[model samples]
Target chain A: MEKIKIEICVGTTCFVMGASSIQALEFEIPEDLIGKIEVTESRCMEFCKDHKDGHHKGPFVKINGEVMADATYDKVLDKVRAIIKKKEEN
Target chain B: MKEELFIEIGSAYTNKAGQDICGDTIHFKKIEDEMRTITVLSDGLGSGVKANILANMTSHMALKFVESNMDLLRSSEVMMDALPICQIRKISYSTFTIVDSNINGKTKIIEMDNPPFVFIRNQKEQVIKNRTLTSPKWSERSLHISQITTLLDDRIIFFSDGITQAGIGTKKYPLGWRREGCKKFTLSLIKKHPNISAHDLANEIIEEAKRKEPNNISGDDMSCAVVYFRKPRKLLLLSGPPYDMNKDKEYAEMVSLYQGKTAICGGTTANIIERELCLDCEIDKTSFDKKIPCASIMEGVDLVTEGILTLTEVYRLLKHNIELKNDNAATRLTKLLINSDNIDFVIGTQINNAHQDPNLPVELEIRRNIIKKIVRILKENYLKEITIKYI
Candidate 1:
């Protein structure tokens, strides 16, 4: 199985808004996907309110160099599955 | 007149009675002669009014359940199941603790899963136990109170984590009063004033904590239960078929058969038996189970609290009163009752169930099997003489 890197921003702005869910996602994912996913807790993703959503509107996470904003557990899982599928196609 | 002992009761509130943020504490003396007393302290998770409601609900439900009908173990199970849970939010939870002590100086303590309890005994402090992530977040910790027999007089202390978090004495860590710090403080108090009443000591500790740090922390809704014991009384327990209204009379008759003044406990039927038999009875009010009738009659007895906790309390009561000696005795008696050989007749009943679909009995079997399982566990763990009979 090929490995995919996952970065979760624990930045003060994101954390204050709703980044708490990411830590939980780290543990909830199944055992088969454990080593396949690398979770890094970074201090700041610099998500500005000036973007698509309003102020304090983010919990940004990156999957294989693709940035996903307002990331939720389900959204992250879907992205991870897609990433794995893309790898298999190659 | 036989000397009837009364439990001293008292309460202290944060504001004058009928105020908004009512941080109040109520405690009663241990049920006479039986060194055991149950103390419940609930710190509603939030602050101000919402906190008050949560705290009150937690303490009221826990006390009413434990003190009235259910034993410590059963009450814990029922309350944990009953508390409301919000699936979306994780932090909205109630943290509570129960400290049950016996006069012979034995104590059993339980803390819910959410907020863990700090056990401070003999100048040593430690977290009671941790709850897994699977447990409800509202329930910080539910600890089985460890037994403390050697202490000359045991004090089952409980307080909301707010007291520990206040950073009064020390604040290097976010968690305050700390299990170790509280333990050392309590032990020092015991050493300094061996005769100081528990009530006064609790107040002193609060005052000292407040004086140490005056940081807008209004002593996070404090409450504690200070229990002491002198002489031990034997425990007497009995239970008939589950939800068997007719068996109430049989239980009353059995209590009457015993020599001591009986405290008949049950619902309306148990009350009826008390009237007919002319025996004392008291209702176990702590239970939310509507199936068991309400009412017990009592005469000149010091104190009467909950009736049968579960099949287990029945075992404890029988052991202390009848002296069955060990597992062999309990097993033999259980075999007799299960086989219906010893008792001339055995009765069973059914309860209304909304969830039953196809082939399940509305009411599960409540006889010697459940009783025997509890007895076997107790006998294997601790040696006690208790026996039960079914008819």
Candidate 2:
């Protein structure tokens, strides 16, 4: 199966909003999902600039082509597992 | 009419071995509005605090008088009469050399009781004629004055007696390294690195002078100052994202079209450039400092760093004139600012909400404030020409 791509935004807003913790996903990937996921860093995806109302939101991550906002370590990990499981079933 | 050359002045000094402060003083002022520069180097009669005060007073008075349009010869005379005499020695003594130059034209050098300034042109020492001026008030003293039109790549190097007299009473040189020795050494340096900066060249000469002393400790306060006429070095610094997202492409275009070295100081700013210019930004994981975030690499950008944090660190470094040691983002940025003669800043007005949190450290000041502080220091302290544009 083709690997799922993960691009984490390491831009200033995202990094300060806890993207650094999500970056650790590279080292802590579950054994089942290790080889199936390819992780990379985006200097910024500019997702934070597209805010709802007037509030700026960040710490974004993209699974394949889908972007997840306000991302955390567990949220990113669970998303990666779900993507990998779906790819297997398909 | 001759085109104006960027005049780069660099100076270095070492204290008498046991003293914490250098007694030799070097001061320079660039009158930007007038397109001129005045540099003064003074060495006091003795070593330590008293000498420091004497040298400091002489250089300050000399610089101020010249800046006010006083005649260079008259200024030297006034400075001489103003200094107090050392009672035991029965001499009011301090040596000074002043180099006053018009950026687009000729340079006038005045020397009194210090080693004659060394003039280098085309990688060779060029001889210039000097007229001796003596004031009847101090008939015992004479000033050597020279006026010459300087070309690109010409360098004027002057130093205190300590530099010329290093290693006195030693077997290597019973008579010490005189003006001839200093001149010969400077010529050798220019031959080796024809493009060496005024700062590095002056530093190298001081280091060599120190080595001539016993145990590599200078016996007296030593100093060397160099003035080089050359082309200006340019740098562009981009930080923050544009307030209007639509302007991102224009901002990125500015980076692409700039002719000199470029640095991006914020992540979102880098992202805008990466996207609009179709360039890749890579994280540089090899070096890290606990205080500063790690730097990133990009196709055309010379440096990439986290915005507020790295800029705050840079402001502190420039404000205090701190010496950089680590290979982190802040030091790299500081070094770039120091080496460049002209700096242009493009700052985005976008507000980062994450930085507005009161819980954040106090050092994380607003981006505009930090850049303003950096600009003031670069202009006033480092004598750099700077321009800023807000997007």
Candidate 3:
């Protein structure tokens, strides 16, 4: 199976708004999902700028182009696991 | 068109042993509009507070007079007449050396009782002719004036009598480190570190002079200044992401084509460069500071740090003129900023929405305001030329 791409926004706005905590997603990935996913950091994905007045906010994380705004460690983990599970089933 | 040489002026001084203040003063002014620089080193008659006052006054007046383009001889005569005579010594005395140089042009040096200035080219001392001028009213005092067309890699060093008269009665040399001794030492130093900066050279000369005294305690108020003519060191500091996402490529191209040291101060900005330039960005985990974020490494960039927070720390450090003892991102950035002669700041105008919250600490100031403060400090305090552009 092709690896899932996870890009975390570490921009100034995202980092201060809890992107730093979300950065831990790199290490907290479950052992079964480690090799199946690739994690990277993006300086700024500009999601905060795009969704200024929307329900979405930052720290933002993207899983295969799906942005998770106002992201947290557990939220990212759950999303990553769900994606991996779906990938396996498909 | 001829390229203007960057005149790096550096001075260092040590007070007389057990004295709270140095009796020697070095003053420098850069006339940006005229593309000229004037540096003056003054040594008063004696050590302690009285000497400090005399030296300060002489240097201040000398700089002002030279800036006004007054006649050097007449200026000296006026200075001599205005100085107050010491009650105990029955003489008002201060020695001064004034260096007026036009960038990419001729340099004029006027020396009084202070030691003759050392002129070096290609690490070798060059002989220059001097014209002596005297005022009949003060017949005993004479001034030596010299003019030379400065070239790249040339250096002019001047100092107070303290440097020459160190260790007057020492067992090693009763004569002390005279003019020849100082010259020889400077030449040897230049030979070792051919591209030594003016700041380090001045500091090393002062340290060596102090070592000549007993127990490394200077016998008099020692001072040394070096004027080095050389190419300017440039640095490009990129911070924040551009407001228009389409301009990210242009921002990265600026970093790719910059002809000097480069630093990235924002995570988002670094990401854009990394993506656009196809460069790898890796976090250096060990460099993390409690307050500032850890720095990253990117190919061809001198420094990569998280924005806003790191910049704020840099501002504090530069403002306080603090000595850096930590290997954190902020200190590293500050070191690079200070070492460069010319700095170009590319500030991304994109606002970070998180910073807009009022509850956030006031120290997390808007990025533009912080950068403006840093630019002012760099210019006024460190004498660095700064150019800023908002993308």
RMSD of each: 28.3, 3.8, 5.0
Residue B81, candidate 3: alpha-carbon lDDT: 89
Considering every candidate listed, which one attains the maximal TM-score? Answer: 2
The model with the greater lDDT, 1 or 2, is 2
The estimated TM-scores of all candidates read 0.38, 0.86, 0.83
| Candidate 1's DockQ | 0.00
Best by lDDT: 3
Candidate 2, residues B139-235, lDDT tens digits: the string is: 8889898998988989999999999999999999888888899898989988988988898899999999999999998999999999999888889
lDDT of 3 by residue, B1-391 (tens): 7764698888999999899999999989888999889999999988899999999999999999999999888998899888999999998899999999999679999999999999999888998999999998899999999999999989999999899988889998699998888999999999999988898899999999988888898889999999999889999999988989999999999999999999999877888899999999998766754456678899899999988988989999999988899999999999999888889999999887667766543447788999999999988777788899999
lDDT of every predicted structure (CA atoms): 0.47, 0.85, 0.87
Decreasing TM-score order of the candidates: 2, 3, 1
lDDT score of model 2? 0.85
**DockQ preference between candidates 1 and 3, better one:** 3
Residue A40's lDDT within candidate 3 is 77
Tens-digit lDDT string for candidate 1 (B39-155) = 666665545666666666677778777666466556655555565553455444566666665544455655663234444444344444433322343254444445455354334
From the highest DockQ down, the ranking of the candidates is 2, 3, 1
Stronger candidate by TM-score (1 vs 2): 2
TM-score: model 3, chain A: 0.84
* lDDT minimum window of 10 residues, candidate 2 chain B: B355-364
